[model samples]
Target: MNHQTRLQALSAFLKAQRAKILPDSVGFTSGNRRRTPGLRREEVAQLAGVSPTWYTWLEQGRDIRVSTSVLDCIATALQLTIDERKYLYALAQESGSGATLLKEQLPEISPSLKRILHELRFCPTIITDRRYYIVGWNEAASHVFLDFEQIPSEQRNMIRLLFTRKELQRLAVNWEHFTKGFLAIFRAYYGQYVEDEWYERFLDEMKAVHPDFNILWQQSDVQSAPEVLIEFRHSKAGKMLFHLTSLQVQGSTDLRCSIYTPVPDSSTEYKLKQLIERK
Candidate 1:
């Protein structure tokens, strides 16, 4: 296909994927009469840091230059996987083929890795990539987070839910800990990637709804915590204390897995016993 044809295809792919957004999913309210898809074009434009007019042109595949920096920004706005991100860069290429950043393939986790975690059933374990997609999990992991499998793969992003989904806010018993991750995840994106329209677009959207976000955005300091101790009221496990563990990917160093350990010999253990027995 011609370069223009290629760009249009990729751009259309992104729009189709994004148009399924729910207003509350992105921290907006869809009025009754608004007949647009998930989020409006303006919402995506506002969040992605392009003008409605310019971004519309992009969706239409106008001959405007699509820079690598812009693609990185768009990638963040769309919450793309590293593989998906590389595809974006390839399509954004001006003339010919270009190197796609990030790994070609992430090495498969050894069978030993799964077996080791399986033995520690009380230690809630989950393997998630940079995109925060759950890749692996143990029973404990299932107990800690509710309805994980029920969530659509695209909507699994923690940051999107933290700000948009009401159920998540309620489910995440440790709001502070989760909020910190949200801050760190977005901050890391900003640090490794370029400053683009997407940054401003999210900021503006958050500012419209959450003043605290605006305050934090201005400070520009985000902390990443490897170990998290939090309490959750699980449907099956009941109220439990968990010690969270996070490990970064070895080769790409982009993926992360987190395991939450139940506190030793506590009432939480008793509660878990009672709940599991009842089932």
Candidate 2:
């Protein structure tokens, strides 16, 4: 996006976020009548330790340079989540140069990588792009999860399926927590690609179909891909736990391999073995 557009987006985002905060929540007295829903611009300036005039100018999208420290103060005053804070920095152009660049065209998965995914007979593995599109998976993954082959290629997004696919939802033990992690991770990626049309369209479609998606997205929470333990309930395998590990592809910018390793000291390993063997 152009400088002008970015400034406008920043302005709108600030106003929307401000509208969500209540006076009582921030320890302010809501005496009688209030014109606006959230803290006023002057109140935000006071909390952020800036002149009201300057803050107003910033909100108006005036051509101004915002320092990192000032941005942090504003973020704190707004009670922005980590992902939201990063997004604020990005919109203000106070973040790193890399945040401004568009993602490179996704490269095709190499034969070697496909072989690696296929060779993992025990571990259920799947590959996803930066946007959580399920680009590839192994048979074991199909067995543990749903059959990706049955789903249309265009609709193979992991996030989309997580919300829309009933079978996948049944597999996850804690559906709310499971979906939130994916949403948070997706939100972080959205911050980087705010200018991308695909992200905008995907979000709009998801929000339209699922009310929960709209609500969770408004929270603006963010999380990096960390090692996490996930429990799954399969019809044949029963209760199984897996250590989910995500690895970045060595040569590709977008490709990430997510492997579900059976957690040790549990029946998960034996169950997975039997399940895979029967399949």
Candidate 3:
């Protein structure tokens, strides 16, 4: 897109985002005389610590040099999602970095990675793309988690399943805690792929169906891949606990391989064996 088009897009995005935030949500009273849906440009300027005229010029798509710090302040004022924040940066043409791979350019799983997952017979292992779509899995993963083969290609996302899949939710002993942490990592990835529209669509669809997702997303929590202990109560296997660890796939920046290892002193290993045997 050309410079003018980018500016117009940024203007529209800022307006749309500004419309989503209620004045009362950001410590302003909803006076009866309001004609707009959300906080006014002046209110946003106050929150962002920018001049009202300058902010108005930005919303008007005027040619202005937006510094990174100013963009971040505007993002904070608008309460944009990670995806929305990154898209704002892209639209403003502020990202000075070189070209990076989009999600569409994600490479296929190498044979070595496939073999590694296969050999991890006892561990429930799955490889996911930047968007948390389950792209690779082993037999253990199929048994421990729901069978990825049975899930439709579009519904193979980990966050989608976490919220929409009733069985998985019921199985997770600490569903809220686990989901929150997982969502934080997803937030990190969501911010990187500014060119991908799929992230925005997926986020909207998820928030539409799950109110909790909307609430959690608004928290704006972000974390690097952290080791987590997850406990599950399978219908057949009963109580099981596993430590989840993530590793970046070699030669691929957009792929992550996560392995679920049985926690020490837990019956998880024995239970996984039984679960796999019945599979």
Candidate 4:
């Protein structure tokens, strides 16, 4: 979407949201016979702690600048969902040119890279681009997680799977912790391409498919990929632990390889071996 189109859409979305909220919903009494069903523009501005004229101009789709803090206030006043808030930010801030650039520089994995993944016999390994798209994985990875080959190419994002895939969620021993950590890592990477159309679309799809994702996203936490001790409750192995490590591919700046090694002095190694054999 272009800048003008985004502004128009943003205007329409804000108006629609404002129309859905009743005066009583924001701590005001419905004292008089209402001319409209929802709060008026001035009333919304007051609730959001912004100047009435400023808010009016925003609703009017004037070429006005909006800060993230102000947007956060407006989101809270309007009770916008995480997805809605993200959409609002995209419409307000994204230039759309970054999407074109990103597309031109899309990451690729070679056959040798796939072979390397397969060669990691004891460790469950997977390769992803900066956007967390699952480009490749090993047999051990398939044994630990779902087989990426079985999933549609477009739906192979790690963050997407974390939210939408029930099996993965079930396997997580601490789902909330794992998801929060994952989201933080994603958020950190997203900072580099906040205005990209692909990122916007991905965020939109995630919010649409998983409402819970929005909640975590709103936290605005930033974190790099960390080597952490993670546990999973495998259906066959019962329980297993691994030390997760994320390393960037040497030549491909955008590509990252994540490996999960069994913790020392645990039955995780034996369990992983058995799991791989069963597969």
Candidates in order have lDDT scores of 0.60, 0.80, 0.79, 0.78
Regarding lDDT, does 2 or 4 come out ahead? 2
Q: lDDT by residue for model 4 over 226-269, one digit each (tens)?
A: 77899999988889999999887878356788899999999999
Ranked candidates (TM-score, high to low) = 2, 3, 4, 1
Q: Predicted candidate 3: what Cα RMSD to the true structure? A: 6.3
Residue 80 in model 2: lDDT: 90
CA deviation > 4 Å runs, candidate 2? 1-48, 52-65, 75-85, 94-106, 250-252
Residue 31 in model 2: shift from native, Å? 12
The deviation in Å at residue 128 for candidate 4 is 0.9
In order, how many clashes per candidate?
A: 4, 0, 0, 0
Native-referenced Cα lDDT, model 1: 0.60
Cα error, residue 143 of model 2, in Å, equals 1.2
- Give the TM-score of each candidate: 0.49, 0.75, 0.66, 0.63
Model 1: worst 10 consecutive residues (lDDT sum): 95-104
Per-residue error at 253 for model 4, in Å?
A: 5.4
Displacement of the residue 10 alpha carbon in candidate 4, Å:
17
Model 4 CA RMSD to the hidden true structure, in angstroms: 7.9
Tens digits of per-residue lDDT, candidate 2, 1-279, equal 456666776887788778888988888877677888888898889899999999999998888989999999999999997767888887787342333223344346889989998888778999888778787899889989889999976678898898888888899899787788777777667656656556666777988998888887766455556578999988888998999887878773567788999888989878877877785
